[model samples]
Target: MSAKTKYTDEPIGPVKVIPDFLPPPEELVFKEDTVKVTIALSRESVEFFKREARKHDTQYQKMIRRLLDAYAVAHSKAKQNEITAKRPARRR
Candidate 1:
């Protein structure tokens, strides 16, 4: 007598199984204290961003975020000074 196989011999086209429909798997974790930002730019700038992103192996939006964050931190005082100096003098 021959032993029967437990698995099927037919080929499956594609698997549509979702492992974690209700929650993330053990290897995946969620961050709760993250901030989300949205920026709008021209198509040309977006292409430039994508190129830079590829060079750094990062997403374009992440590159923009890093740049904006650094600029805000480094130039906040200078920006404030410029805005204050631009205000017109009030007449007596």
Candidate 2:
């Protein structure tokens, strides 16, 4: 058995008040524009996502969507860089 905690009435030194740094309730709820699509994926891939999702306690479809979104974002930035690199410098 553990010893019981003792309560003290001692003053806890100077305290600073911090402003609210969190967003409002409405802003806390994120709403993303999404579209429904039907596509066939390999059984192995689907199973993999399902297993991972179950382990993380989240929806498998969300994991797949986030993966695809991340891939698209990364590739898009790389494509933009390639395009900029190919552009000739102005003879100002």
Q: What's the lDDT for all of these models?
A: 0.73, 0.86
Estimated TM-score for each candidate:
0.44, 0.66
Each model's total of backbone clashes: 0, 0
Per-candidate RMSD, Å:
20.2, 11.1
Candidate 2's error at 74, in angstroms? 0.3
In terms of lDDT, the poorest run of 10 residues in model 1 is 19-28
Per-residue lDDT over 4-23 for candidate 1, one digit per residue giving the tens place of the 0 to 100 score: 86898789788897543232
What stretches of model 2 exceed 4 Å from their correct place? Answer: 1-29
Q: Write the per-residue lDDT of candidate 2 for residues 1-92, one digit (tens) a residue.
A: 99999989999999999754444678537875889999999999999999999999999998898788767867797899999999999798
Candidate with top TM-score is 2
